[model samples]
Target: MDLTVIWAFIIAFAVFAYVVMDGFDLGIGVLFPTFAVGPERDRAMNSIAPVWDGNETWLVLGGGGLFAAFPLAYAVILPATYPLIIAMLLGLVFRGVAFEYRWRDPGHRRAWDFAFSAGSLVAALAQGMTLGALLQGIRVTGRAYAGSWWDWLTPYTLLVGLGTVAGYALLGAAWLVWKLDGAGQAHARRLARGAALATLALLGLVSLYNVALRPEYAERWLTAPTLWYALPVPVVTALAGLALLRALGRDTHAQPFFLALALFALGMAGIGVTIWPNVVPPSLTIWQAAAPHRSQVFMLVGVALTLPLILAYTAWSYWVFRGKVGGDGYH
Candidate 1:
């Protein structure tokens, strides 16, 4: 594979991983209000605490990779999606602050907990909006944003935004099932089942709408043999969704969450492949937007070493934090 192509795939994969991992924590935050009081919420928070910050490493890597490897695309996309980007950052800020303050201020823990949950909801919504806007394609004229802010908030984009929220919520519920036991696990399983159904409906709607609105995408999928191969992603994802439902019904926690993550991974991979060669989609192809070869080479060397370290540390942290959370305790 060409160097630029390799970097593109690596960066895309990293972003997808971040979405699948950190996404659940954010979803947990969004779902906090529903779970209510005491050990349950604390367990939910604790389940993600050890690795939440580390999960963001991939976001940084993905963004940095785009900046380094595809400067033009970054310039175009950042300018086009500045509002949503700012919203996402603000949500992250709220979440981080809430994470620290909720633990320290016993007096106002309830308020902080709500803040954390709200932050998560806001962040997930913003991310979904951003994804929707990107998929809808930015209006670029000679490398400049040629559209108004309202252009990013179309009906299709709104559908995708809500779809992503449901998707992340499902992931979060799946996570809770695995991380907590007894009442918490049961509650989480119910939440997961509900979220999964909503996600399935939203996914179907978004897929149908996008195909009709952007017929080119449908053509690509139908015409290209390689793209046809990517169809199994959705197929397998649906099967996994069914399996998760079955497992939830049987009160099987561990396997359901793993299967849910697989479903997410497969969907992400399908999109990545569908949009391959086009980092910014519709307009800027990776090679067309890529920075100088020397810059990409230099960045690759550092990324090669650091990425593994990040992965290892993340895995180790999860391993250490593995098992049940209880009684609003800190260790």
Candidate 2:
């Protein structure tokens, strides 16, 4: 396979992993307000406390890889979306501080909780808007960003941002359903039902909005050759959505979480189908933005070695922390 293509898939996988892994914990924070005070909230927090920090590793890997292997794309994209990126980073910082401080200082736990929820919500929204702005196409002039500062803040971007929030909320609800029992689980089920509906509705809206944003998107998905590749995404996404709703109603625990993740996976697949070969969208193909062959090969060697290690340890952590959390478990 071509080295640039290999690097592209690697970066894509890293990003996908980050979204699915960190997404749930962020979702937990988004749903934090609805959680009852005391044990209910504590159990919700404890459910993610062990694996939350580690989940962000993929974000670092994805960003660092993009900078290393696709510097041009990163340079242009970052400048165009500086506001969103800054907001996302700041949100992450506050979320991390809240996560740590909530435990250290009980006297100010409520403030920390607010910080956590606000930070998570902001981070999720910013990330989604960044994706939207990129998809809607960043204005590029001779390999540099030519767009104004506020270009990232559009009605379409806002729709995607809200969609992302709803999706994360669904993931969080599904996670709670799997990780908690009794009343907490029941409450999570109720939340998941509503979140699932909102996520699916917004997913449809985003896909339609994407097509309307650019004819290229419409051609890619609706035209021949590409249509064959794109056809199954919607079909499978619908199935996953149905399965998720069914799982939410049933006695199953892990099914709801995994099925919810499937919905995200399908959505990512749809995006890949729509924008493959293009790193910055409407322009800047992966080949155009890729680093030199030697740099990519050298980096690939390191990724090949470390990727498995990251996956192994991440899996190990989850396995170690498996089973329902209740009454101050694993805290």
Candidate 3:
């Protein structure tokens, strides 16, 4: 296989990892007010506090991989999706500020908490919108974006944005089930059940819409050999969702969360396969968007060394903070 293709896969995997890992935590932040209040909220925050920073490392690596290995794709995508990118960054900034300020100032803590939730909502929504727009393909005339700003913010994009929020909420709820106990656990389970149902419905709707818009996708589904191969993803996702539901019903916490992550991974894998070799769906193929060989080679050297270190530190950080948050005070 080509080195560019290998780098592309690595980068895609990194981004998907970030989404699956950090996505649930962002969902937790967004849904904080619904299931938690005061100290419970603090505990909820504490549950993710130990490893949240490390989880974001994948995003840096993913973005850097794009800039280094596929500079042209980066240039095109960043300019076209500038607004959504800015929104995502701003949300991250607000979330970080809220995370710090809520713990420091007793009186204005509520304000900061609100900021955190709002930020998470904004960032998640923006990301989903970007994904939808990318799948729909940009109007690229030569090297420039030809689409209007309004074109980027369509009804389909908005629906996808909401779907992403629901997906994250499901993830967060599953996390909470594993981390909390008694009332918190019960609450999380309820949220998880509801979120799972909603996510499934939204995913179904999106899949239908995607196939309707691109009839080729339906053809892909109809073809026996291809459909048989593709069936594993949705099949696995459905099985995971069922397992999560059963685990939640049985009050089996840990397995449900793990299964929830598996369901997310399966969904991501399906989409990745659907859009293979197209970093900017429909418009730019991976080979067309890749940077020069020399540039990619140089970037690979740095990634080869640093990626493992990042993964190790991330794993170690999570290991260190493995236990429940409880009333042990903030770290």
Judged by lDDT relative to the true structure, which candidate is superior, 2 or 3? 2
What local lDDT score does residue 27 receive in model 1, on the 0 to 100 scale?
Answer: 86
**lDDT tens readout by residue for model 3, 1-331:** 5888889888988988898788988989878889556777877888888877678888888888888888877877887788999999999889988988898997998899999999999999998898888776777777666777666687778878888999989888888888877677788889999998888888777766766656556666557777887778777878887887788799586787788778777877777756776888666888988888888888888888988898788788877777556665343
Per-prediction TM-score: 0.95, 0.98, 0.95
* Model 2 error, position 173 (Å): 0.8
On residues 1-331, what C-alpha lDDT tens digit does candidate 1 reach at each position?
4788878888778888889888999989889999778777788888888889988988998888888888888888888788889988999999999999987998999989888988888889888888888887877788777878677778887888888889889899988888888888889999999998998888878766766766566775666676577677778878887887888889576887787787777767766755666776677788988888888888889988998898898888888888766555342
By summed lDDT, the worst window of 10 consecutive residues in model 3 runs over: 322-331
TM-score attained by model 3: 0.95
Ranking by TM-score: 2, 3, 1
Top model by TM-score, which number? 2
Q: Estimate every model's Cα lDDT from 0 to 1.
A: 0.82, 0.93, 0.81
Rank the candidate models, highest lDDT first.
2, 1, 3
lDDT of 2 by residue, 1-331 (tens): 7999999989999999999999999999999999987899899999999999999999999999999999999999999999999999999999999999998999999999999999999999999999989888988889899989999999999988999999999999999999999999999999999999999999999999888889989998889998888999999999989988988889989899999899999998998988888999888999999999999999999999999999999999999999999676552
